[model samples]
Structure formats: C-alpha cells, structure tokens
Target: MAWDTEATKQKLLNAAIDEFAERGFAGARIQEIAKKSGCNRERIYFYFDNKIGLFEAALVQQLVTALDDVPVRGTGPEAVADFAGRYFDFSTTRTALARLTVWEGLERGYPVGAEQRALRSTGKVAEIQNALPSATMREAEDLLLTIVTLCNAWVSTPNIHLVLTGAPDLQRRRASIVRTSELLAQDTV
Candidate 1:
C-alpha cells in the first residue's frame, strides 16, 4: 500500500497550526505537534525540514486560506466595509490565524514568508483601490492594513476588549468595526 503523503502533510500542518497558535514558535515542541497529528516526528522533519519551516508553512497556509475565503467583493466604500465585516467574522471563527499572527510578531519580530505574503497583500490592496477609485495606492494599502489590524486585534487581544468594554462582546465589537470601516472607506472616497 502506498502511504498518503499529502494526507500526512495536511494532518501535520493542522496540528502544527494548533500547536504554534497556542504556543509561539519558541514555545511549540516538535514532539507535541507530532503527537497531536498522530504522526512520527520524522514526518515533520521530512515534510518541513525543521520547526521554522513548519511554522512558516503553517502561517502561509492560514493566510492563503483567509485571502481566498473573504474576498473584497463589489466596488464601493460599502464594499470595503463589507469586506471588513466578513474578514472580522472569519477572524472570530478562525482564531488560530489571529493567534498565530500575534505569536509571530511577538517571537519572530518579522514575517516568515515576507515576499509571498507581500504579494498576497498587494492583491488585496489593488482590490481596495479598485473599490475606491479616488484613493491612491498608498491610501488603499493603509486602509487594508487598518481593516486587517482592527479585525485581528478583536480576536487576538481579548484582554484588551475586556479591559476597554468591561466585558467582551463580539457582536458589539463586530458592529463597531464594521461601522468604523465604513467611515474610513468613506474618507478614502
């Protein structure tokens, strides 16, 4: 019987995401990831070369999935706001991405797949520019960054939400973020 290399790699990636999200790259253990995936440690080394490689792959996977999932649809300030709302919803459910982002910033101090991630981000920025014709490229990039930062913060920094709001209210925060995005989009236009 042939071994399912893709399935094994996917399982390892899934487990690696969970492990890295919960415990930053520095704290995550290869053994723990292997045990979580029910694969031998050798598979991790073989598939990813090392822990850093696995971490970068995991982060890139999450980012690619996100870009595919919540696309900037329509063409207007409202579209930008809509994208922000959808991205916020995505972040809330897929907390691992947000957590992983936080962990990467804290531990690495630089992005793992910088060139690839930048290319992906450039696409999104172009989408924003398309939606808001009045905005410059730099403005669109800043807006995209602002929307992402806001959405990610709500998920990754629950303590901040609790401290500011006296309690964590996902719905309230989501609404606030959406409205904020809309206002920012209007300004861009």
Candidate 2:
C-alpha cells in the first residue's frame, strides 16, 4: 500500500491518534506512542518535531480525511441537512476524533496550530453561508457549530444512540440532525 513506504511515519500518526484520543495532550507520551507504533522514539521527532507537532498533524489529518469524505457542494436546507448527516455519520465512525479534539481543547488549550485547523474548516462554513444567502456569516457559523456540538454530544454520551428511537442507529442520528436543522432554519426565519 502507499502507506507502506511511509510505514513508520503512518504508524507514528496512527499511534499518536490513539494516544491523543485516550490520554489527551498533557497525558499523551512519546514513549507510549513509539511503543504502540513499534518504532524508536527518535522517529517521531525526526518526522514531526515533538509530541505537540505529532498531535496537531494527526488532528489535521483527521479533518482533511473528513472533508474528503463529505465535500461541500450542495446548498439550501436539504444541503445543510445532508452536511449535518454526513458530519454526524463521520464523527460516529471516527470516534477518536471527538475525544481527541474535545480533550485537547478542554485539557490542553487550542492555541497551537489552530489557524490551520480553522482554515480547513472555514470552507464548509462559507459554503453553508453561501447556500443561505439571507443568513449572515456569524449566523451560519453558529448554526453549523450547533449541529456539530449536538452530534458530538450524542456520540460522546454513552448509549445515547440506543435511547434514540429508530429502525437503525444511523436513521435515528439522521433524524435528529434533520430535526435540529429544521429548528435552526425556522429560528433564522
């Protein structure tokens, strides 16, 4: 596979993702990541400066992969609903991302490399704003954040999806997102 040539680097990234997900930034360790990745400690520094750099890189990679999976193209209420559904599904599938991101922001502060992260996220927000021409940028950002926060909360809370009523968990989650989007649009109107 393409990742084989960069096996060590990819291992380090994957290890960092798990470590950061489990332990957050302050608690995550280079030794543990190296051990998990089956590589020497020097390899991390050689590839990514330090633990901070590695964590940031892994987080960035997660966002990039998410964007690839859910590209910003369609617009309107249905488009917004589609984005919300896609995002919720992505977050649920990639459970580690919410844990890592939440833990890092809560325990370790988000100043490090936030600009890059925001830049990548901004495209989606802008597209949403464009879709809803009547909605201001701030309003679009707020609505988008609310949908993300709700999905993150649902995923973070244990067995919340089970409490949810539907034939399948995805159906339940999608219903919740669509309902929330409808509320947001109504409030805007």
TM-score of each: 0.97, 0.83
Best-fitting candidate, measured by lDDT? 1
Q: Which residue pairs in model 1 clash with each other? A: none
Candidate 1 lDDT over residue span 79-174, tens digit each: 998999999999999988899999999999999998898888899988999999998999999888888899999888888877777878888888
lDDT by residue for model 2 over 1-189, one digit each (tens)?
Answer: 354538788998999999988888888989999999999999999889988889888888876677567754565676677777878888888877777768767876754567877886687678777767777878878877887787677656656555664334666667888778856855654
Candidate number achieving the greatest TM-score relative to the actual structure: 1
Residue 41 in candidate 1, Cα distance off native in Å:
0.8
Cα displacement (Å) at residue 27, model 2: 3.0
